[model samples]
Target: MADTVFFVTKASGKQEAFDLGKLQHSLKRAGAPPSAMPEIEEAVQKMLYPGISTREIYRKAFSLLRKASPHMAARYKLKKAIMELGPSGFPFEKYVGKLLDFEGYDTQVGKIVQGHCVPHEIDVIALKDEQHFMIECKYHSEQNRKCDVKIPLYIHARFLDVEKMWQQRPGHDHKFHQGWIVTNTRFTDAAIQYGNCAGLRLISWNYPRKESLKKRIDRSGLHPLTCLTTLTKKEKQQLLDQGLVLCRELHRDLNQLRSVGVSEARLKKVEQEVRLLCEPESPIL
Candidate 1:
């Protein structure tokens, strides 16, 4: 019943009431067709128990969406796909660099820079139009982990050190510089507060209201290669290792798939999926 109160278990081991609105909203955002909503809602509701895991619910919705459109299912899988970007986090850093590059910013990933206090490894450095950003990526494999205040605290201190030296460089007298913390998870309230007070920009999965990381990815249409449902886990990891992080890369060169010994038939299916994924969507007017 829509009026029924049922709790769901989150990945963090916490239980909270499930809201159908949230589910429907996420489905819509994934481009799930309106016609499919009633069936998905009814099915998911039927499966609800005292403490059904959120992950299970997600799987049910994803399975249904895949049947309707694999591309849409891929979009729904974006969050988990991002987590799949690593145990090392390098792929995610490189992925962020690519997103910045798509926006016309010259970007570097995994660079060592000398800070005023010490040498620091910046996850990503983006420059455009006399503006410089020293970005530190905080990647978590777990969905429920939140970036706490200590993260922003440490990042701000490191950024201050790096910015000091950066500002001293020639031709940077008037350039604007900033320190940013980008994470795949949500930020703790304290963490966001510290970042705001310290002038460090914090970008999380849903933070900053309108300009969150998810929004940026959707706006840019730069879905990660891991989002493809057509590829197996090993195949995706192999491409990531070879520096192919975006679906656009595979679309541009199917040889990358072949290099991994993907048969011609499989490659054709992958190509079709890539084509659909990479095709630009018309703007909603």
Candidate 2:
């Protein structure tokens, strides 16, 4: 018999396989007749890939399921996006929750509240002993810039809706404490000031990076964002907000490298180091 290959997602591992049994079980429990299981199983097991991203798996799986049942497919996408955006996955809420815990706050990761205010599903709430913290966390990497401004708009919306959420509880506005907009990249100092004054606490947390993914993408020579020039006015602004992540390897590297006078001996040492890097590995006695 030929060796069987399993489809895998990068979010999990290269050898991971899609859970056909779980899918079949869910379908059965949800009143999807037993006869439908075989087709779903066949469809799932056939999704083969050497390495696939979580997002790509989401896209592919939904596409497969949507062909047969569009409603369940739509529901699945919403649930997946929610989990990805929440504290367990994305950096914004993840970092915020960790920081709060470090600061002696009792924090609950994700608490879903259905309201006209949050069509986006849920907002991460934190309780610092007695005070409550309502954080509208949005994460945007250099790949997508839309969050830079959309985040501010979300803050405004939340502020406007706060009273409505608490109107029934009688002078309980303090129950919803501070608002935080946590992000990976830094913002203009001016934007920071504006956000603070507007009652939206912008927490720009810089993440440590090793290699530059931008340089990697650039080196690939793929004009992936070529047609981005034709983006609409709003879209262009959104695109500009996305900043590339480059190395900040050593804070001390810069201070230590200041105004060095290179001698002939130093030059030889540098060349020797380069040659050592080029040499093949050896088994030492």
Candidate 3:
């Protein structure tokens, strides 16, 4: 094995040697078939070159995986595919609400409520078993950017104002309220520290290491519609605009796809992929 060694440029602009083992591990996590690994690896080797962006590598790998298993390819691309949820954070907020819904929570998105000091536009509000969570969803279009300390600080302040209002209103208990900040990307170290110190629930792509946002979503089998490879951009947007944010929602209602002009053949393919992607799995983290 005397092939040229290759390096990959990461989203952080850092470079590292490409490792076959790492790729294999990710493929396995994505539920790719064991029989297809060797072929995918060979293809990746043929595509590797010095200074290649990891994004390019991922795109190449996804293309190959789609041929063998569309479900696996979509799952493998989950992290990046989520970024396509919006030009704004609203879509991500709705998607998060849907995930919470899957977890047996009553969810509300984009609601405005009056605080003691000011009116706050909440991103997602999840209520279950008498506990309420006011979630602030921070969505970044670029992978390299992060949710910083200031975001949690702002969220905490708003939550506090709302809490004060609740306290002032006789018979309204404050113990039921909790503040959470969730992001599509990781958070800065200071942000995590502040969140922990302030008792705010912070969920990000890889933060809270073991119980990260990705792991939670995967465990709940609540992937966003963007994770499907079967839908075109127009089709996805149509569904998103219609508030069908989760794959499970789309899967449960095939007529929604048909109503949006998705062809019968493509609708069947999408349904199959959605079914596999949302299959019940053992708890993660």
> What overall lDDT goes with each candidate model?
0.91, 0.43, 0.86
- By lDDT, the better pick of 1 and 3 is 1
Residue-level lDDT of model 3, residues 91-160, one tens digit each, is: 8999888788878999999999889889999998888886877899999989999988899999999999
lDDT tens digits, residue span 101-141, model 1:
98899999999999988999999999999999999999999
Which 10-residue window of candidate 2 scores lowest in summed lDDT? 243-252
True lDDT of residue 70, candidate 3 = 95
> Highest lDDT, which number?
1
TM-score attained by model 1: 0.95
Which number leads on TM-score? 1
The residue ranges of model 2 lying beyond 4 angstroms of the native Cα positions read 1-92, 115-120, 143-147, 170-176, 206-285
TM-score of each: 0.95, 0.36, 0.92
Q: Write the residue-wise lDDT of candidate 2 on 11-32 in tens digits.
A: 3244465555656544443233
Decoy 2 TM-score against native: 0.36
Root mean square deviation (Cα) for candidate 1 = 1.6
* Candidate 3 residue spans exceeding 4 A from truth: 1-5, 174-176, 281-285
Show where candidate 1 strays beyond 4 Å: 282-285
On the 0 to 100 scale, the lDDT of residue 99 in model 1 is 82
